[model samples]
Target: MRILIVHNLLWAHYKSSVFQALQHLVDQQADLSVQVLQIARNERSRAGLETSGGETPPTYTYNYELLFDRYLEETSVRERTRLLLQRARAYRPDVINLTGYYDPAQLLLLIWAKINGIKVVMQNESTAADQQRGGWKERFKRWIFSQCDGFFCFGSQAAKYVIQLGVPPAKVLLRKNAVDNNALRAVYERALPTRIQQQQALGLKPNNFVFVGRLIEAKNLPMLLTSFAEATKRSKNGDTWGIILLGEGDEQTKLIQTIHTLGLTEHVILLPGRPWFRVPEILALSNVLVLPSRSEPWGLVVNEAMACGLPVIVSERCGCAVDLVHHGQNGFVFDPDQATQLTQQLMQFMDSAVDMEQMGKAAKQFIAPYAPEVVAQEMLNGFIKITN
Candidate 1:
């Protein structure tokens, strides 16, 4: 069966789980031919420009900037519709999978696919309660979903939402976000030594906490910093722990100011973000990982941290919290906006080094079922069922 996958290419960074799963399916199913059609708005002009011992060109992926540009500048509704129709005619796919976001591309693609007699499957982000309201946007989304052969949701919450959106319960498929465990294991094995060496170079002691993700309001970095400050006040001399913030964003200057004003200059370290491959090493060197996001559909880094055997503290708003994190078991879950809860959780981890180690072991065990090959097969089976 020929399956044509359509999604914004920029999602490639965190969506490696999807790509890895697709590759796994291709490897296992001889009859399956997969084609990825990325409806990218603009190609990177700087992608292959430099080759010497020169500065590295900035890497671009699916992010706010790219998504904004795609929607605002490069393509319009009519042009995008035309492009999808063109691609569909050429590919002639048995099954067309549409990934959901606020973007119009997926919706347009689904509409065109329906008119052309192709089986369409839409994967969306709505969770139970949010599905009940069918505003104009929701109505349009519902129209697109109703015409599809199947609807795929990220979790039970999203599946419930799809049902609320007026989709038949049998049409909705629950597909959870997954990690590429074998690839993650390989990355962890390779990064462990490098992380230790880097820690020595940076003068960081063992058992420090690390936070990964963009420094945006949604990530709640300011709240985390404030909570860390409060946690430090209750600690002995504030020298017992260190915190590292990874990833860059528009809020860097404001976050820096908060660190300085809070007098946490000595404890907090800001490291520029590295590629996904370098993350396992960073997690291995840390005693714990914290993702204090105000709102997150899914926190992929939580799975990455768990794969590295590091305990995590994630916000309750994260979609992955339900499946990946178990409070007081693998990791703790705190209300994203509640600094006191975050501080309390931090103190709990800091209080006992033995407890931290045990939690880390539990985290690793918790994520063992989400190996890339396993999740990929599940996705492929879903695709097969839809197309057949």
Candidate 2:
């Protein structure tokens, strides 16, 4: 079996990890082969996160082909589309995995694969809750879903979305999203002993929650700030738990002003976005992970945090929250619009009565099966199911 996977970017840390595992798995098989066509090095918003700060070079690498080591935005739309079509035809794959329906190029390639009697698997992360459904878009999505032979989904929410689109339950495989769990755990554990010193050095609170993602309106930064301030007001030990916002975007100016207006400058610290590899160090210093996105397909930061043994506070809208967060067991899931609910959940984590260590351990244990290697096997199983 020869599988050709088309991915958006070479610098996508999560996808790269999964591809590495898939490649490794295929290597041990008798007649199995896997190859990837990385459309670009990075997207425009992600350019900063993709660059290497090291002097020598990247020590860690993915064993695959980078079709274009430049951002897609650097090239004309026509040129990029042409490149994908040309590459897919040349590769002559027995089976192909497309990025998603949103990509016209990949969708066209998926159609081509079907026409040529090659198996096609689609990657879907979108959940019904993440967006406003109904209209021509949902109908178009249903048509696309009907065409694919198999699906690899983010979680239960995503799987359900496809089943609603007329895809049989048996045709959908839920691998969930994953990070390089071992790598994150190693980075976090290595920094664990010096967490106190590191927090002090970084001028951060000893016990704080960490929010790592783009500072956009959809991320609900303003709402998070409002909720945080409310939580502080309700807490007797208000000085103990602070928050660290680690990412940059258009909403930075607004988020900063809101933080100051809310009188949270001393309590809430905002740091410029760092690359994926550097995130685990920040996670080590923090007590919990909070992803309060108003709309999110899947929150991969939740996976990274859980892997580092940090319980997460995720929005119920997030696709990963359904499968990964166990609602007060491993973490808490709150309605993003309800400020009081968020405040209550935050207080639950901040309370000294709560055994955060046990919750973190539960988080790590819950996330073990969502590793890249495990996801790779699920993908292989899906491919086999479709091919047979």
Candidate 3:
């Protein structure tokens, strides 16, 4: 069986990990083959995340054909659709996997696959609760999902949204997200001994609540700062822990101003985001991960933090919070709208009321099931079921 996977970017390290694992599975099966058609090298939004050591290297080894030599954001939609159709026709895949319904070009491909009698599976990251949904877009999404033979979703919330849109439960396979756990953990463990030194070098406290993502409004950076300030003041130990924001965006300047306004200059640190491989190094220095997004689809950083054995404090709005975060167990989930609840959760960690080490262990254990190998096997199983 020949499978064609359509993805938007070759620079997506997380997707590359799954694709590599899928390739490993295919290598063991003589009858199965997989090929990916990537729209471009990277997106305009993440151009800074791309490293330039002469040229950016492939994050994972897999059989993929990049349709355009550069990133797709600058490419013409008409040309992109034409090229995508040309590749799909040339590949002649028995099954095709489209990334999501938001892309009109890929929607065209999905329609073509249906007309050609090819099995189609879709991978979705969005959740109905992530934003206000109702209108022509919702109607269009339902119609698109109807054409799919099956689905691979980001998490339970994402899966629930798809089922609500009329997809049968049996047709949905994956309901989780993961990173290169072993690979990330290996680097993190190697840097464990020097974690303190690393933190001290950055003028950070021994313990930190780290937020790693784009510094945009949706991340609720202002709320994080407010809660962190309140948590620090309320702490009996007197501002014992620090907060770190790692990533860049338009809100960086505003976030800095807010930190100053809160008189948290020494308490909060803002670092620019690094490439995927280097993120584990930063995670090693922090005691816990914090994602306070007002709206997040899956938040892959949560998975990366869990793999590194750092307990997370995720916003309840995030899809991954539904599955990965177990309140007061592996990590805590706080309502992004309520600063007081977040402050209280942060206080628990600051006071050392909870055994962080035990929670960290629980985090690692919980995240193990969401590894790339497991997800790849599930993907393969879902494909087999659909094709059979």
Specify the highest-lDDT model's number. Answer: 3
TM-score for candidate 2 = 0.96
Q: Per-residue alpha-carbon lDDT of model 1 for 144-253, expressed as tens digits?
A: 66788887676666776678778888776545766665566677778777776888787775558899877777788988889888887886635767788987778999
Error of 1 at 12 (Å): 0.7
Over 1-388, each residue of candidate 3 has an lDDT whose tens digit, in order, gives 8989999888888888999999999989899999999889898889888873454544688899988878778777787789889988998999999988888888888889999999999999999878999999899889989999999999999999999999999999889787898888887889889988888899998789999999888999999999999988889864558988999999999999999999999899988888877788889889889999989999999999999999999999999998999999988998899999999988888999899999999999999999998999999998889999
Best by TM-score: 3
Note the Cα lDDT for every prediction shown. Answer: 0.72, 0.85, 0.90
**Number of clashing pairs, model 3?**
0
lDDT of 3 at 375: 94
Each prediction's TM-score against the native? 0.84, 0.96, 0.97
In the range 1-388, model 2's lDDT, one tens digit per residue, is 8888888887777888888888888889998888788888888888777644652312434456676777877766566678777877877788899888887778778788889999989999888889889999989989988888889998899999999989999888755788899988888889889999988888887789899999888999888889889888888877788999999999999888999899998889988887788788899889989999989989999999999999889999888888999987888998998988988888887776568989999998999999999998899888877887
Candidate 2 or 3, higher TM-score? Answer: 3
TM-score, model 1 to reference: 0.84
Each model's number of backbone clashes? 1, 0, 0
Off by over 4 Å in 1: 10-17, 23-31, 41-79, 126-134, 194-197, 236-238
Cα RMSD (Å) between model 3 and the true structure? 1.5
Between prediction 1 and prediction 3, the one with superior TM-score is: 3
